[model samples]
Target: MTNVVLFSGFGSHGKDVNEDLFDRCPDLDSAAADILGYSIRDRLRADRGAGPLDSPSNQVAAFVVNAMKYHAHREDGLTPDIVMGRDLGEYNALEAAGVLDFGTGLRLVHLRAELVGNADGAMAAVLGLTPEEIRAVLRSAGLHGLVFTSLNTPYQSVLSGRPSDIARAEEILLRAGAYDVRPIAMGKPFHSPLLAAAAEKFRDALRGTTFGRPRIPVIANCTALPYRQEITAEVLARHMREPVRWHESIRWVADRFPQAVYTAVGDQRLLLKMLRQIFAESIGPGPTGATSRSPVRIPSY
Candidate 1:
């Protein structure tokens, strides 16, 4: 039974989130307090990373959610053969695959917030256009500052740049036949060169942290491949200062694990939805887990 588990970027739907889910588990609850503070559930649910650190609320909350849910699944004796995540979800994959411990992951995310999260950069999604198309438009518009942050789909590109450049890119994209040029939910140039300086410092944190070998392969968004155990920290740090090759990573997994069953955990509906689309486009419609034609099933977590 090949099971590849996935983690979503940003976060999952907050509707079914259990504010007290961690309270039922001692370790998970304690981890929450380590970075989330008292009233962990309530504070996380509130998205007010307004504690002493004041990290980005959305990012910290998503990290907590992914970690909590992964541990819950582990407590139930569920383990996946392959683990992967998009954007911030990479930490979830690392922790799940035994790379970083839970508490350490939390602290790293907090540190990431301090270093990489800034008001100077912004992110937005340009829908109904390919990365190449977006680049062509950028070239035409002379907006060299904007960069492809994440290639979520063949036709969808997440872009990041300065606030002014993002505004200009949006206007130019709208005028250049883009179906929609909307700002990402929590707009920031997350995985773009704009974060290089800060991400370089975050690299020091990654190197300082202890990294264990993964029990299962953990695909990284930065390279769209399994992370090398020896250079795991460097690869993770690069995720902040590089474009996310999400489309390629998903496809690589599907090709590698033909007939593999995909199992999504935590708040992964968005990622799964993108997976379906990715498969539909690359391999044609129908079941979209393994290869285009491989029989696929999404087993319940």
Candidate 2:
């Protein structure tokens, strides 16, 4: 079976892999810590207080930690045929595909988080609602600010926009038989046109960074296809303001590789659940031969 490595976004769980990474690669440890605004160990030990992991520093830290775990797996001689990242996890995916070095990826994430920090919005998952259903509700309710953000599966889609709009939409969706309308633990409305200004600013910041051609087939969240075009600053910036077409991306994988193992590289099974949902929604028993698994948590260094 073909092996594919997937990654989830920030605000997920992490392991104490920093100590070992520092011991083995001090220079890299220092650089990662500097970019993250604290020792990797310190942030991991910070308060578990919730609400929006949108801060540039927190985003950078998450990226660094995930990147470390990915590298640890690589050092152990596991290579992926294709790497996919959801939202912020894209940076780690790029790093894994040899498109960017660890430090470079963290730096780019720092800039992205900074650009996104000024925005004030909320995100929520609208379960048991089709994209068309959600769009119809948005139109009928005249909730202009509410926007469809990420499409996790046919039954699950994330909505982002003004907090009040989201709240009102939640009530409407519930009345319309939505399985659940749960708020995401985030402060900013990401992957929506509301962040178009942030996307423009991020474009400027990303131009100064280096993005190499991927060594492997790196699926893009925007297009749900391989990274065939030039990996430009605009392309990366668009992710901030565009929906993460995760369902399509996963479908692409399933169609291409009938016998494949899908693994999430994080401490949470969030992405794994989404993968299952996508498969569940497929027509006619849906890729019964495909395999899905929990996040592969790499041991500390």
Candidate 3:
């Protein structure tokens, strides 16, 4: 049987995915190079030298979605039994699933980054804390602006809000017997009400966009469920400002694909680490273990 694979990450571009795929199939480098162009190569190199190019999700989505199409055209088609994403990665999965065309998906992601990039905010990883404990701390501190942006795993979650509020919330979480809280380097607060304006702008952008029923199942960030045919661009637009239900979505994947191998495609291996932490006992040893693949860092193509 073909080993089922589950792919996910935040805002990792096509070049990234292509690079990862290339590692598995080295002879495809020329074809990948041809499709990605010189600009992509330069960008990828630069990204490697410096840190990750913040929010390349849209560009990556456009490339990978199209690359899959190109592969489909060539008969050496790319297909995954299940595809999913978290936050910006959701757009990638949407494109892979054929819910949103490449152009529309990329456009939406770019606009999303621009809109959310302006806000002053902060996010932090709260390790060794349950979601309920984190929520209780936020509530007790009267920090109304904070939101639990990511439920990555049972012991790990991300909290996002205005910088001041997040700082305060960090203290509260630490005091409540949490292991540690460290700030994330993201520029804006995502998956919170703070990005409501951006969501509206995204909704407007969606009007001009077209979406077809997906060829594969697409797990949405907001709902963490397989998208129904009735879900429109407007519904996806609303996801921009809403919290990502990553934990539930991952649970869905685990329950559905008990024997599947998960490969997290993106710059940072954050999602991969979380998966290991969450599914520790269930996975076996070695790289191909139920949870074994090393975090694949796709060169920014």
Candidate 4:
């Protein structure tokens, strides 16, 4: 069976996830901590009580945790045929695909996080609303500033824009029969036009960096597909400014590799949960471990 490794972005949960990873991979963990100016364990523990970390520290801690898990997987002699990372996790996938070195990727992530964190915007999750429905809400509400950030599932989408616009959209969605409308604890809106400045800055920063074609196909969060050409500064820059077609990307992978074993990586099983939801909505529940359209199944790490 094809082996696919799915890396989660931010929002890694569980009390012991960071602790266990820190214990397992001390060296890389230490390096990451040094770069971030705080221990990931401390940060995670604080985040448990507080809300999510600001973009910079959040990206740094998540990247380190992802690296620790990835190293542990390699130690167990596990490898992947395909690697997919969502949002912040994309940097991890690039490292896995041999397109970027750990140090360089981490450095870039730090820079990206800083630029994005400094922006003035907000994001919120709208559940029980289809992509079209949400778009309609934005149009009907005249929320020109608000935009769909991520299509996490058939019935879930994220809206991002200025704080006022996002709040307005959230209220509109709630009144329109959304199951839930929750704010995303982030310093800046991601994957939205509000980040246009950050995207442009990041693109310029990427010009000085080096990148190679991935060893395996790496599906991008921005397009929900494999890179059409060489991944360049412009491509990554555009990614920062576009919506993440997560559901479409996962479905594409499932359809392309029907027999692939989709394994969620990192500290939690959020990615697996989302994948399962997507499969259920798209193809309906099938046999215990089978998707309706394919034998592919989402397995947790």
> Judged by lDDT, which candidate is best?
4
Model 1 residue 54 lDDT?
36
Candidate 2 Cα misplacement greater than 4 A, ranges: 13-27, 48-54, 283-301
TM-scores of all models? 0.89, 0.89, 0.76, 0.89
Candidate 4 wrong stretches, greater than 4 Å: 18-20, 45-52, 284-301
Per-residue alpha-carbon lDDT of model 4 for 42-147, expressed as tens digits?
Answer: 8788888887666677778778778778888878766788888888888888888888888788888889888887788888999998988888878888888788
C-alpha RMSD of candidate 3 = 5.6
Return the lDDT, model 4, position 99. Answer: 81
Local distance difference test scores for all models:
0.76, 0.77, 0.64, 0.77
Candidate 1 segments whose C-alpha is farther than 4 A from its true place: 11-15, 45-55, 286-301
lDDT of 3 by residue, 134-211 (tens): 888888889887888778778888888888888888878888989999898765778878788878887887787778
lDDT tens digits by residue: candidate 2, 1-301:
6778888887663543446754655666688866666776565556344433336656776787777677767777777999999888988888888888887888788877877888889999999989998898889889877877898889999999988888899999999889899998766899999899989888887878777888888888888988753765666888899999999998898788866666667644677667767776772234333343322323333
Q: Candidate 3's error at 95, in angstroms?
A: 1.4
* C-alpha RMSD between model 1 and the true structure: 3.3
Error of 1 at 56 (Å): 2.1
**Which window of ten consecutive residues has the lowest lDDT sum in model 2?**
292-301
Per candidate, the number of residue pairs that clash is: 1, 0, 2, 0
* Candidate 3 deviant stretches above 4 angstroms: 1-7, 11-38, 50-78, 281-301
| Pairs clashing within candidate 4 | none
